[model samples]
Structures are given as structure tokens and as C-alpha cells.
Target: MKRLTSILLSLLIVGSSVLGGCKNKNTSEGKTPESSAATSSVAAPTDKEADIVVIGGGGAGMTAALQASQNGAKNVVIVEKMPQTGGNTVYATGGLNASETSVQKKLNVKDSNQSFIDETIAGGKKLNNPELVKTMVEGSAAAVDWINQIGGDLSELGRSGGMSVDRLHRPKGGAAVGPMIVKTLNENIEKENIPVLLNTTAKEIVLNDKNAIAGVKVADASGEYTIKCKAVVLAAGGFGANSDMVVKYAPNLKGFGTTNHKGATGDGIILAEKANAALVDMEKIQTHPTVEPSTSVMYTEGVRGDGGILVNKEGKRFINELETRDVVSAAILEQPEAISFLIFDQAVREKLSAIEKYINLKIIEEAETPEELAKKIGVDPAAFAETMKAYSQAAASGVDKDFGRKEMKSKLDKPKYYAGKCAPAIHHTMGGVKINTVCEVLKADNAAIPGFFAAGEVTGGVHGGNRIGGNAMADIIVFGRIAANSACKYVEANGGYTEPSIVLEEAETPAVPEVKGNFKDGEYTGKGKGNNGDIEVKVTVKDSSIVSIQVTKHSETPGIYENAEKNVINSIIKKQALKVDTVAGATNSSKGIMEAVNNALNQK
Candidate 1:
């Protein structure tokens, strides 16, 4: 298409020359068309224009992008496939685990780095990087602070299944923690004015010679384009959500279920492999003990932390409720049917709202007898009855002699009984591109890849075989910032070009409009109606930044919007790129509007 346009333009120039006076024939004449055209053309920009290019716009990507920009990377570009920036982290519960954090200090809870390290290593079965683990544990507090500074809230504290203290921090809005963190980071990212390209996927890393990083090959609405830069950070995140990758890397989970965002494929991993980056802990896959019964709704471990129980068909506690998630999941897997039940009384249910959201609490088939409940969930009635009797006895005594469950006695003896099926589900991949303490990607020979770097789940060896629930959130924010700081220092020391030298001339013609919207000046804005005509949006962009957006119409129902608007707006803000979050109730509208915005912005 671009070639076609150029061809037409050249033809027009020739026609004008014949009808009007050519510069050759009218050299003596003033202000000829050919002479005017020569003066109007400009040069294209070069790859040496920016110091660093951060790929992937998740929590890790944003952190790297923000830090790089602050550290003096005159120009920074964040490439994200989704319309928004937060990646899988936006879906997180924001419950982070860190010893000696400000929250831990305030609550007077005592913990040590050694203890944290010990638990982490043991939990991951000694497959973790001792040095990277040390860095994560020691630097976690500061990471928490960074997120707070970026506008995240850590006002509420809670506990998770693997923790020894109530040190897990929750956001102000409870379950909205992930969105809040993403929103906060987006605000900080925008303030730094880092360039973010939404709906853009990095196909491959651009190499200068044999190994040193140069730039990336990106594909967007206009098709493939090369973005040149001195350094690249791969924060594209983990491969838990990709079934194919899961089968290839961790075949043990072949038939098992998983809990991961759909986009959590191994794109970053594939690119790293192409670059010959080392992958660590590839076989260590973590599985959650409980998933939603009917579907894959991920229920946070906080439910067990607050006193939920894991019962088998027999309706009795089977394993230590406070054990590490890996242990609990393994125990469930070893059960007779490879299935377990999560049971809690009504009072416990009211306290932990996660149960309802992740399960069909209302449609529960109530039973007066444990046998009946077991029968409903397709379990052995006699075995279930015996198990329930034992559990009640344990509850009465306030002790779990069989499983050593903490908070052992929260009596399951009520008039109404409930049972939900649960099995081990792979949660996260512990393997990714290898990086050093400075967050630089290590080459196959163990040398730093000069200008190449990686962070977050995309960078491996931190958690080894297993990532503690809260540690992931902290790692991305902390290490993301670390990578940024390092990239800037490298650029400054190497004396890379400060101003972008991109040459736009003689490019194949400018691409045609694959999508439609409005573009004027350096700003682009668009308004669109959703399929149901329930949600209408006005997205405004300025100077390559999404400064403001107005959701003029909301046809969305309440409660479901919890993950929609905030996620979209936050991505736009953080990436400073116009992108929309996945539509909640109105998916078509979501894609349409976001594509429209990208269409308008990509105009040459």
C-alpha cells in the first residue's frame, strides 16, 4: 500500500512538471513546484535515537520503562500487545510478602532475611538462585515503597497460606488491588513521559553484531516495523497461561488445570531463546490448591489464611492449611480421586468474600448430612461421613493431630453443609530469561549481554522453582526499577546519541488506514459506541500521550466493571500510549475503540 501511494505521488509530480514548469526548464523562474517539494521533505529517524527500549507493558515493563526514563534515557519506548500496559499484574490481588517492610515494622511483626530465605528455598525445593533470592528478599521493602509512591495503596494488611505473619499488604479497595497498583504505576509512567506503544508486540530482538542488543522488531496495526534503540528490557511476563508452552516445558501438568491470564504465553521466553539467553528453573511449576469449582476462577490463598478448610470426600481436613501452596497442592494431587474439597461454615464464608466470587456459593446443594454433600460432589458417602466425624472431633478439641492445620478448629458443624471440588492447578512458571544482580541478561557464555536486560517474571532464577504469592508483585516493581537505573547508566557512560535521528524519507509509502478514528496536530481523540450501546468512550491523546479519557456512556452492569475501566485507564496512563483494556461486558466495543485510537495514532 505504501509503495502504491509513493508511486501515485511520483506520477503526480511528473504530471505537474509537464502541465506546469519543471525546475529544469524554469531554473530562472521563482518558486517552482519541484523546488518547493524538495524543501518540504524531511529525514527519517535512526535506531540511535533512544538509549533504551523496554518491551512488554506489564508491571515489570512499566517499572523498567519508568526507571529508564528517569535515569536519563532521553527517549524510551514501552511495547505492549494488549491495548493497556499492566499485563497480568493488573489481575493480581496486590497481596505482597516481604520481611522487614514498613508494614511489618508498624505491626511489630518480627522477621529475618535468613528465615525468609530458608522458607523460600525450601518451598521451591532448593531450585532458586540464592543470590537473586537474597536480592528480592532484601530489596522487597523498597519495592513496596516504590509502588506506594507510584500511587498504589497498602493500607490494609492480610495473611496468605504460606506466611508466618500478617505482613501481606492489600490495597485500599480490597480485591481491586491489582488494578490499583497498575493505575498507580501508569500515573508515574505518564509523569515521566516515556513513550508506550500499545497493541504492539515485539516479534524479535534486534541484534547489532553477534550478541549485544540493538532494538526490536515490532508488529502493530500498520504491520511490522523496526524500532531501534541501544538497550532492550524483556518484561513480557511468564508462560503459565499458555497451555502449549506449559506442555513443552512442564509436561507433568499435561492433563492438569492451570490459573493464568490468557496472554501469559511464553512470547518473552521464545525471544530470549532466539537471543541465546539462559533459562533457569524451567521444570519448577507451582500449582494452587484451590480453583473455582465450575471454572478456573482463581481463589486467593487468603481464604485459607483466614480459616478456610480443605476437606476430602470424607469432609475432613486432609493437610496443613497453612503449609506452603506447593505442599498443599501436592497433597491434593496425591488424594484418591486427585480431587479435594474446600469447606467453610457460613460465618467463615461471610468473612472471606473470595469464596463467592470464585465459586457458585448460592447454587450450592445443601445437605444435612456429610454423606449427602459427598454424594452431590460425587464422593464416597461412607468415607465422607467418617471424615466429617473426625473433623468435628478435631474442631471440638481445637487441634488437628492428623494434618497439623493451623487455626485447626473453625467448626464445620452447621445445619447446612457445602462441598466444592478442587484440584491442583499450575499457577506460574519459574523459568524465564536469565539476568544478573544488575538485571542485565546473561549471554550463553555467562557474560552480560552489554545493552540487553530483563526483569519481572520474564527474567528468571529469582524464585527458582516456586514464587511466593506476594513476592512476584514486589519483584516486578523493585527489579523493574533496578533494570531501568542500570540501562540509563550504561547509555550515559557509552555516550549514545541523545536526539533521535530517524529518517522518514523514501519509506515505502505511508500505510493506509486499517482502522478509523480522528488525528489532528500531535493529538488524537475518538469516540465510539459499544455493541450494546451501554458503554461509550472519548479517548484523547496529546503529544504522543494519552492525557485524558472520558467514559461518557456506561451501559455496563455493576460489579463486573471492577476489572474493566480501571485496568484500561491505568494502561493508557502508564504506557502514555493509547490502548484499551479488554472489554468487560462489551468486548467488541473495547477492541473497536482501542483499534480506532491505534489507527489514528499510527498515521504518518
Candidate 2:
């Protein structure tokens, strides 16, 4: 089952939205956010002990734990809520972005960190934390070198949206890099003998009277427990899995198919918020263009990198295919049916993979003539032919006059034409819990929560408003290591965990429940959306108590939402109300369940 899940995850991994993560605001260097805590002050403690407790088992969390162990943290553990590690890390399909790496040097490609930084800032619309972006840019080269050292590779390089240079580095085997990186990290974890507790969910950030992190409360199969760790690193990740949160926060992107796995829900974000960590840019989500229309499958950006043009129903080129995902997505969203088609010739079809699958899945249409391809995909046949001709002319002339695209890798003149219906899907969430350069989680007042830190997709202030393609892996790697290095040093200075003489009073706010209403209730039913489709539920109320909640219909992705479904219904029934921290990463499904329950009990 694990093997099958991993295989499916690898195949489904696609584009900047699924793989890319992180975003930010301004800072001269990777300084604390304006709302940062001043010191790493400690107050109370609890029952168990470990040098560090890293939450989530994805790229950031794994890397942070390994780095900490490497730095001599004797007792380090990774507490993951799922049965296995690899959050969005296992869903990555793109290459890492680095400047002036060994691969670039060997290829004689002239690139600089500053150039990378300039493009990233521009891509992020200048809302990025200049400091964090600079850190990632500076650390990018080292990050690539580190990945290589850790049994990974950068054998192939390509260009992605919003970048002028060919800095996107692929894995050694091919475009499939997610599993390789995950395997390498997992192997490292095994070698270090790091303890990983699967199916363990972090319930709360236990703070002492000093308003500082003391320990964490976690729940596992055995029930809830506490682990007294000197430091907690929240590499848990973003909230793409929770449809309700997405709708509430980024309403502009509501109802779009999301590219995140169910576990990609914003667990660490909530944990941080409860811990007094201020979040940044929570509304900015990166929706990648060219996701397979009407499906969650994502077509890799390499299609466009190898010269694929997106044409609308009128068979006309819209925007530069090589622009940032944010720009390309906006352009596609403006088209009819919120869809377009990716047009390419034999040369592109041959070099690019995913062709057979696209064809088999009926996601792409192939024809010997542009007109035929256009007809099949619902485009104006004559206009499509003309568009192809114009594209060919521009390719030959080295200038795209219609869309002002300068990067022309090939012309769409060859025979055996191919086109795929393309649309955008909500991919990466740019907004998240704020963290400083050293990976320290910050409070609402801009102070560093002494024992709290975060990295990977969970921490914000890295990518800004728009994350440049191929930058997510680089961000996680660079900052994950920084977090570990900082955490280990922190453990040493803070000494071993000890029970303090105090009771917890300055903790986080509990999940607030709605006021009980006087409603003549027996049974009610309603429908709401899960991640992709509708979720229907039947609510049973007895004597004003939510006695039972049963899910009637749902098309949510399996494995991802099973736990979420069981959780949301159970919680509402147990609490007899709709106040609960959404099942960590399955917020959308949970919301749908709640909505259904609400629908069922319409205060008759």
C-alpha cells in the first residue's frame, strides 16, 4: 500500500503549484518579521524530553531533523501525522533553482545569485521579504551542492516561467525527482537512526507562563501525550488541502481544482497561530496554468519550456507561456470556460514525456493537421492554423510580436500536431506562518518564540506574492538546513529539558464553538464541496445534541480525506457543535462535512 501510494504520488506530482511552496514580505536581510518576538525566553516544562521535535515528515521537516542530528543533537524526533513521511515533498515534479552551481559551471552557463534574486523579486511583485529571498538565492548554490552530496542529482537543466536563465535543475534520472529526493532523505534519516512517530498529530503548542514555548501536545493511536522538547520546528506545510480555508482566505481562487495532496492542509499554520505566531500574505495562492482540465492531474511546465503555446477557444495565443505562473494563470482564467489548449509540434511531443499518459487519459488531442487538432479541442480551426503559422513566423524571426514572448525554443510548424485542453489549478499557497532567516517562528509582536521555529512550505516570507518556478525545492532545502543548524545550537544553549515549577496559563486560544441555538432538530441533510467534488452529510440531533453525523456522498480523493471525514464528523458529534481545528490537512473535506451538517439542520 505504501509503495502504491508513493508511486501514485510520483506520477501525480506536477508543476509549480504542486511542487513550489513559500512566499514573503520585505526585509533588508533575512531579519525577523516586523512582528517578531524579542528573545528565546523559557518558562515552564512538561513530562517527556528530546533535544528537538520536528513536525511533519516532508522535505523541510526531514531535512531539518537530519541537519539537527548531524549537528550533534543527541535526541531528535520527527512527529508526523500521516502513516508516512513526505508531505508535498513527495509530490514535487520540477527541478531546483540555483545560480552558479557546479552543473551550471560545467555547462558553461553564466548565472549569478543577484540575477536570480532580481528575477524572483520581480516575479513575487516585490512583496517578498528581500532578506529571505536573498538568503535562498545565496544559499541556492550550496543547497544544490548539498543535495548532490546527499545522493541526489542535477543532471538536466531547463528554464521555467519568470526566469531569464536556464537554472531549473532536474534529477539525474529524468523529470521525476520527488521520490528520489524523498528516498535520499529517508535513507539519511535511517542512517541517523532518527525516531519517527507516524500517525502522530501535534494538537497544541504548550506555552509556559512566560509566554514562551515549553512543550507540545501530540496525539497518536494511543491517545494524546506530551513531549518535552527544547525546541519545536514546524515544517508541517501549507493549507492547499483544505478547500474551506482556501475559499475563506483566497476566495478569488475558490472552486478550482487544487494541486496539493490532502495532507498539504495548513496544520503548522494553525499551530503557529495558536502559539502566537503571526502569519503573512495568507491570501496569495499560486495557481499554475496548464493543469489537465476537469482533472487534478498537472502537466509539467517542461511542455511550455520546450515550446508549447496556450491558445484559447478562438485559437489565438494569449500570454507569454514562459511568464510567471501568476500571470499565465490570470491569462488562462480570462479565457472562455476558464480553459485553453497547449499547442505543440512533433519535436515538442517527442522530447516531452507525459505525452502517452495525456493521450491515454484523453487529456490531449493529437492530429496530423493543426485544423484537425483545433476542431477536436473546440477551437476555431481556421484561426488555429493561422495562429500556428504566425507562431512559426515569430519563431523563425526570433520575436513574438503578438504576445511579446522572447523565449522561442521551437516553432509549431512540424507535422503530427498535438494539443491538450489546459486550465489553471490552485497550486501553492504563498501566505503562511512568518519565520526569520534562522528559521525561527515569530510572534505577533515580531519577537522570536524562543523554542519555536519553522521551515519548508509551512513558514511564510520566502517567495513573496508569486513564487518563481523551480524555487520551492531550493527554498525548502536551504531553509530546512538553516532551521536545523539553528535548532541544534539552540538545544545546546538551552540545556536539557526539565520540568519547571509552574502551571500553564498563557497558552493559545482554544477552538471557539458557536453558541447553542434552540432548534427543533431530528435530522437534516445538505451538500457542500470537498476538495474536488460535492460532500453530502446527514446530521442526527437528539434532544438538541448532535448525536451522530453520517457522510452520505463524497468524491474526495481517497486516502487523503478518509481520516479527515472520520475526524470532522466525530468531532462535531462529540462536541455537539461546529468548532474544531480542521483535521490538520483536510480542511476542505471537513468544511464540506460541516456545511452538510449545517444544511441538514436548517432550524426548522
Candidate 3:
């Protein structure tokens, strides 16, 4: 059964959004976010105790905590800096990679560890951790089964992609993979009675008398507190949110913005460095080609799987859209100014749901003449026309001689041409604190930091330079479980370290049944979005937990409302002992709902 779940997880790990795991405003240097708490007077720290302290709340962190509990940790805690628990996972298109599995047998797709490995190395430029990647490839089938046991259904949709077979599986609803995995992991956490601390940021690692990892000093609403734990799992994601880091790591990419969430700073890497963990492949950054250049929000590579084409200002196809992300992105970079437009007719758009939502129906600018459209986007009219002519001829003949683009079945001939201006944006950071196959953080000299572990983008060396479309979620699940199992074993072997006093604070807000309406603040329009919106919410507490919520009005897209609604309801229930689920697509709407919930809770 466990094996079956892993296989299902691998195949179905496709539907989640990338959330721009690591991107920053400035890419001048791979610098950490300027510490907001630096100038402020440091608060005196207090020491609390736990058997395991997982430093993130994504799939990896939750998995580690659950495993720790199963391994006999009486007191385990997950410290998340965000108000929410699931990091980028909640935004992921849930898909996983498995080999030689029952799904493959059922689907009649032949697969093996070698073929998977070859594909990964080929797809990623041989930059992946050979051993760790090996483990992932070999153990993927089993991992999928385990995920299914955790609440995901194995029998789902099968999509075709860069794999040798239909090894990619997706869950029903075809929504965000992050929330689904998170929901399942959270369930296991509750069933085991684990403690999760939200809106908590770890400041520094607490080293004991022996200079080994002792605990983590964190800042929360109650001020600074030290969590003394024997084991610490660093699952704080990547540095994509840190603009400085992006610039420094990807020097070629100037003014490179990101679509990652704001919370995805390289906190784990900094904390691990403070603890002397080795950082590897610090230079290898993954630049996903098709991210919305302005918003930095991802549009998933499944676009190509849905039959999109890459064309220049001339309306000519440039590279093979079906090639690996890195190759395709690099090919696109060769354009005159490191920019090109992704062109597609309305006919192809009808086939891909994600592409339609992201790129819309237009393929390029309409200017009565191709030359006029070229001038609009600043392309040389003659050059653009010639390029387009060449491309149309090649595309019509069914051969992409220029860049070997095999998936040229779709033509760019349409009355209304639309083009998405694309540039290479720093997307995923494939490097960070090094970890073993089981996700234990390895030291500079090559050994496990007994009580320290890392997962997700925080611990690098997984993919050497680039990551496959749906592979990251698989990485999280694989390593998350590893961290959890390891932590649990550590706790079972040695009981919890020590427990310190938790100074509970007074409640400033009261509770309500539910808040009505939405936060309709007409500030920003969807015409040309520039920045991500941030909202502050206060929840009313009764006895130490939230009771209910209320909201005003806010403007956001409706597609995200589906999942956001349920997430708000579930959030209310879990802390309130109610049964609520996360909405499917409406993230901002859900957030607004949470804010309303918090606001209603404040009525003392």
C-alpha cells in the first residue's frame, strides 16, 4: 500500500503552482534580506524545549514532524515564519515521478531506475546529487504509495510529458498540489497531536556547550524564545525571495524579478551557515523560461505540454518548446536582447487549461501588418518579417531546423496574434545547505550534523542546475519524510532534551461566529500589476485558540477563490476543533477570508 501511494504521488504531483520559490527585487549580490529586527533592541531570549524542532511548515517540515512523533518524540514543534503553514507546497501543482511501479504496469509504460536517472541527468544538465537523485528515482514508487496512505487518491489522471512514459500522475480537480499534500500532512500531524507554531521566525541557531546544535532562537508575538531540541530540521525553502541573492547568483540576469512568495527568503541557508553547514553549488541557479515577466508568478511548463510555441517579434518559432526548461530558456535567451515572445494561436489555447488562464487567447500584437506589430514591441520590421517568414516555412514543412523544436504541430497563423513578452527570470535555486539522502544536514567535512537536518530548497545539491517541472514537490515529499523519520528515531533513542516555560500572552481581541462580505478596496487593478499585496489580520482568541472570523472587501481574481474559501474554513476548524477544507483556486480570497476571521476575532 505504501509503495502504491508513492507511485501515485510521483505520477500525480503535477497540478500545484511554483509560487516562485526563490526570487528577489535586486540581483546585485546573493545577499540575505536586510534584517528588519537588526536595529531594534534585541529582546532577551527564553528557552523552551522539544524533542525535534522543524524550522519550516511545508511538506518537508510537516513530514519531519509527523515522522518524529511516530518515532516517539513526546514534544515536537514546527516553527513557520508565515501566518500560514504550508510554504510553496500549498501553491504547487501536485505531481510526482515514480519508476517501475504498479501505476506503470497498469498504464503500460515501461520504466526503470536507470531510465529515470538518465532522463533526470539529461534534463537537468548533470547537476543533480547523483546519490540523492538515485535514491529519489529508486524509491519514488514507494513514496507515492506513502502519500496515498496520507489521504491522496492513487487512481487519478495520467498526463504525458518529457518522461519516457506516462509516469506523471495528477490528483483529481487538477488544482494546487501544495494544499493537497499539506492537508494530508496536517491531518497526520493532528492525529498525532504535534504542536505547530505559526508566524514564528527563527533568528539564530542555539549551540550548546559542545558547539553542536542545541536549539533555535525564534521571534513570535510573544517575543524571542529559544526552542531547545535535540534535532532541528531546516526546511525553510530557497532564497528566490531574496533579490540580492538572485542578482549575486545569476549575474547575467539583470533586473530579474521573481514570482515566488515574499516569505521564501534564504533564512535556512543563513541559519545553517551560522551553524557551519556546508553550502554547495551556490552558483547553479534555475531560471524557468516562461514565468510571467512582470508578475514573476509562474505559469507552469505544462504550457508546452499543452502545445504552445516560442516565437520572436517576427512571429517565427525559435526553439523547441518540448525541450527541457533550461535548454528552452537558454535558447530563448539568444534573441537579440535576451527576450522573445511566446506565440500561439487561439486554437492551441483551447487544449491547455493552464495556458489559457496564463497566456490568454492572444498570440501577438495586431498591427494590420507584421512589420507594424514588430515596431510596437521594438523589433526591426525587416528582420522580424524575414524571421517570421522563415519560421512559417519551417513550421509548415514540419521541421524546426533552427532549434530542433519537435512539437511544431501548431501553426501561428491567425488573424489575432498575441505574444507574451518573456525573459529569463531567476526561478529555482538548486543549491543550498547540503543534506544526505535521508535529509540530514551534512557538515563541511562530510558528516551529519547529528541533530540538524534540511529539506526543500533550503538544502541544495538535489538538482545540479535546473529542476524538472513537477519534480520539486517530489523532492519535498521524499526529503520531508526522510527528515521526519530521522528526527523521530533521534527522539525515540534519546528522550526530549528539556522543556522551558512558555510565557503565554493576554488576548487583545474577542471572537465572533463569522465575518460577512469581502475586502473590496479598489486600490490596484489587474491591468498591469506591479507588486504583491500584503494584508494584516488579527484573530480573536478564546482560551488560547481562535473561535471565528469576519472580513471586509478586497479585489482579487476569482479563479483562486475556489481553494481559498475552503482553506479559510479548515483553518478556522483545525485551531477551533472544527472541520473546514481549503478552497481550490482562490488564494487571495482565502487570505482575505483569513484576515476577516482574524478581524472578527479581535472584538473583545
Question: Can you write out model 3's per-residue Cα lDDT over 1-604, one digit (the tens) per residue?
Answer: 0000000000001111112111001101111112322335433435677777889877778777776666666477778776455676665652666777776787677778788788877776887889988877777777678888777654343332345555655565344455567667766765655655655789998877776678998876436668777888889988877888877877766577765667778888999988979999877777778765665556555445544556665556677677777887787778766777765555444544344334332333455555666777776778766765666677788787887665554555553444567767777788899888877788899887777888888888877777876678668877877787777666556654344233222211232334332332222111111112333333334445454333223333321333243345434634462234434334445555555554444334
After TM-score superposition, what is the CA distance of residue 343 in candidate 1 from its true location, in Å?
2.3
Q: Report lDDT (CA) for all predictions.
A: 0.64, 0.74, 0.61
TM-score ranking from best candidate downward: 2, 1, 3
Task: Give the distance in Å from residue 286's predicted Cα in candidate 2 to where it truly belongs.
Answer: 1.9
Report the candidate with higher TM-score, 2 versus 3: 2
Q: Give the TM-score of candidate 1.
A: 0.73
Q: 1-604 in candidate 2: lDDT tens per residue?
A: 0111110001011111111111001111222211123334322222456668888888889889888877777477777777556688765666789998999999899999999999999999999999999999999888888888977776677788999998988774334456557767876765665666656689998888887667889875334568777789889989888899889897877778887877888988998898899999898888888788566777777778878889998999889999999999999989987888888888877765434445545666789999898888888899989999999999999998888888888897888998888789888888898888888888778899888889988877788899887898898899999999888777778774333221211111222223353445677777876665678887766666776677888765433455566556655654567655466556777787887777777645
lDDT of 3 at 321: 73
TM-score of each: 0.73, 0.74, 0.71
Give the CA lDDT, 0 to 100, for residue 278 in model 3: 92
Write candidate 1's Cα lDDT for 1-604 as tens digits: 0100011111011111100111001111122233445564423222234568788878788778777766666477677665445667765763776777787787687877777777777776688888888887888778777777666677566666666666667764345356566666666665555555555678999887766777898765334667777788889999888887888877878876767666688899889889878877777777877875455656667666656677765455678877877888889878877778776555555655444544333434557777777888777788777776777687788787888665652566764666566777878788888898889888777888878888998877888766777778778877888888888877876775476332111212211222333334354444444332335455555544555555655432222242345444544544554654464332545554555455545656
